[model samples]
Target chain A: MLHTYLLSIQDQDPTKPLESFGEKLSYGGQMLLLGMATVFAVLCILWACLVIFKMLFHDLPAKKTKTADTVEQTVTEPVVEQTDDGEIIAAIAAAIAMAESECEHVKFRVVSFRRK
Target chain B: MLDAIKNFLGTTGVAQLFADSNWWQYLVMYVIVGVLFYLAIVKKYEPLLLMPIAFGMLLANLPGADLIHLDFFFDDYYISVEGGKIVGTLANDFTQFLQAIPNALYSITDSSIVFDFSEATLASAGTTMDAVNATFQEFLGNAATLTDGALHIKMSHVIKEVINNGGLVDILYLGVKLGVYPSLIFLGVGAMTDFTPLIANPKSLLMGAGAQLGVFAAFFFALFLGFSPMEAGAIGIIGGADGPTAILVTKELAPHLLGAIAIAAYSYMALIPIIQPPFMRLLTTEKERKIKMTNLRTVSKVEKVVFPIIVTAIVCLVIPAAAPLVGFLMLGNLFNVSGVSDRLSKTAQNELINIVTIFLGVSVGATANAENFLKPQTLYIIALGLCAFIISTCGGLITGKIMCKLSGGKINPLIGSAGVSAVPMAARVAQDEGRKADPSNFLLMHAMGPNVAGVIGSAVAAGVFLSFFA
Candidate 1:
């Protein structure tokens, strides 16, 4: 009776293996690394496509010779200056002023030189 | 004693100072000191910055010394006290000063609004009765004290509370931390930029795009090096070589990396004159460098206004992460183009930019605490950052070469390296280097297109990284 009760009470199953929680955690980690690697691979592909586009379209032949016409249309009066320094400075100042007029944030004044 | 003598000399002046030190350590120290002295005295690569950075390197490398301690600002605390009782507080004097200055500036703006006294307050407080009482007291031989009859609470306190609660520091931080100010700085940048040369040649924009290849390349490299996507993204933005853009991207992705990335970006920028010229000259022959660009065409004012809005809509829609930066930049540009809100534009340009700059510089500098900075990883990051810049420059130049070949020698590959968005500096370098190769070559006008385009490209790259990572 005792031997029969012991055999019945043990209820041991030899077919199934015990699984630890660490194995589960490692499985999650592996999945995460895989996901990241996949994302990086995709980005790299997109980057390659961009590089191809830049290379292909960078230099198309210039057909129209509109340089002279554009030059004539946009030409403005050149200012007279007293000296070489004045002319160079005035040109820079005018250029800066034009840039500022367009962009509006840059204020460049000639701090040292007095304008006549 | 002899060994000690050797140690001192080996550590600083001579090899004997490092007699007890390992051979490699002595070599590194000597090389660092020598390079520092050269840069400080000769190259003058930001004497203020390099000087401190060099000194920091020296201080850090010194054995058994805490002089390079990073705890000076971190360990201290500042708190406001009224009548020996603690009231308001901050962690550092910098934050306290940052708070105080803004409040002081605001109160002083319309001095009358804050200071003007009303007769009603005096009347309500019975000031006239108090004066009459004072006369009666004088007659009775005891002077009346003006304390009890009339009392007034200054509105300055109210303003202080409002400004403090509204957080002048936070708003100031918006400019510094969030890069709101630097975005506005684009206005000044815009005003200063000469797109005519670029407009005369739009091909330069391709060079600009080429330069941005470094930013994207850095992202991929960082990923391979085991940085998390977010960190890799933040680190890669350094390739942009634009401080504001770096700050903007880092603030969103990895705020912790802000200080390192900002320092790296700015340091590389200032070092461009030194770092880039050698490479440019090395990569190209004298003939290649001397490729003269055609004269640039005049850009219409209408085109300028449309450019910003179009860029904003397209970029923001495509990369929503870059909206804050690209939005503010275009808005600032719009102000300049519209010419309607001159005052608002001026304020954005000067006062706003200035206020933001000081705060941004100091706060970003302060973020470099010893704990965050003294890691082996930081060394790697700095090295990677330098490599990224060099690689990007090479990438752009190489791409430019391909384009030049494709274009049948019409395009100057030199300007393509300026694509890194160091702005006018990079463009100017290309121009200067081009002239050195051939005095008549004018690449500045052509380089501007790519230089400006590099800005947009870096921002877009940053946007792309942020979108995927953040």
Candidate 2:
């Protein structure tokens, strides 16, 4: 009788081979690891997809040719001051002269400057 | 005078009210509600959500009231007070308040009508039984659960209980029970959100993924602590620090634990400033905190418009269970960026979200009756939620530190802690820490990358858990 009861107690749990928190702990650990792996995998794929998408669609910078590089002198913007209209005009004149030199064969025309 | 006195004593619920076990529970719940009110109002701890929740808790725990009871929708649930005649004491005890009631009021079967609402379905306790009996006959064999061979009650026992049974709060609770409120809230969140940071620097997605370690860790803890797997899932998602996500997961996994989990999640979110900084400082060195990230390239309008569509496809395909939340979120973002429908975007961001927030907060609060809220398990849930938040912050910081080193010191570890999905709040904390370390460092926009990614990461984790447990 005692032997049968003990067997019944041990065999009662049909779901898992382990008992109580032990079974849950094992399953929880597996899920924990799996959850972390899946989250990372999903996010990483998203990250990669975004990178690829951005790169594929992004406007690639125009390739630098010898003439293009020679003509394209990087001009820094002059910081504007409230009362520096004289200095601003001088800076504009210098930029115009440089641009005129870049395309020496073209005739230069000036337009009126109106601050909006 | 002697007859009137006898009648008052006989009709009043003063006898059974004190005799019931729920009396002390109600008393204690009142005190608890008072504290919540003080915290929400004076202390301003998440007052937007907390104030309504606290008021709901107060309404639910008020003695001698059936404003938020689980009674059915039969005609017997109400009392007829037409012509000011005391014809019925259906279920509620009106006592002296009966004089203040309207000509007609709906009362529960076993109580007298104490309040008045023009919208209520009214009947007499004594005279309407026969007619109500005829109506009850249609639902007689519809649904009933056997209880001690006497009282039989269940869902089909009532028809349209959402509207008929619940006076005010119960009507709002329908959104919460059906998971509509949280999903709608996600739409508003999506509209308000700007994903440019995440788009500019996609690598922060890994840090967002890292922060979710706290979510699964807490699940493990809850299981060991003896919660069922479903209950553990609800408790665990509080670590995600995303209130709507927590509500959605709990509504699926363990609806019973919803109130406690929602309260813990929102309360802790409000406390992020106090809760996260210490762990962040403890996890990383001063030098690492001072590292500044280079400026992100300006994201174009096309990228913004298409980003939501791609993310929705990937997330939904990967975790179909997260479709309502992540799908709505992405949809909201699409509406915002597509710029075709300014009306829809404005609605989602402001009017729709604010309305849903009110319903979600009060309804969630109403679910926490004295019976459920006043328990040892509630304390355990609160503690476990706090631990989960702390561990999640630590996880993000730890990953940030590693990433900072791997990038040849380009990444600031401070931004990693923002990966726990508290939105601009967590990001702000990172910026604050960065500013403290070096006055010139501006980490706000940089931290936003991981912060927004954390939202997606948590939603994905929620989907994974839902697949397992739901």
The numbered model that scores best in DockQ is 2
Candidate 1 overall Cα lDDT vs. reference? 0.57
Tens digit per residue, CA lDDT, model 2, B1-470: 99999877755555545757778887888787888788788877788888888787776666555666533332334334454454433323322333333335434343333432322233433323334333433434344322221223343434355565456776777677667888898898999898988998999998899999889999888877778767887898998989999999997777778788998998899889899999999988899988977877666677788899999999999889989889999989888999997899999999999899888888788778888788888998999999889988988988899999899999999898999999978987888788779866777777888999999999999998887666
Q: How many backbone clashes are present in model 1?
A: 12
- Give model 2's docking category: incorrect
> Runs in model 2 with CA error above 4 Å?
A1-19, A60-116, B1-19, B70-159
Please, what are the lDDT tens digits per residue for candidate 1 over residues B75-156?
A: 1112233343333322243233324322222122321112112456546544444443444344321211223322222223
Per-residue lDDT tens digits for candidate 1, residues A17-115, read 213344323322332333233323333333343334334432221212245446666677565443444234434643453454357556565566555
TM-score of each: 0.56, 0.73
Candidate with best lDDT: 2
Give the Cα error of residue B87 in candidate 1, in Å.
26
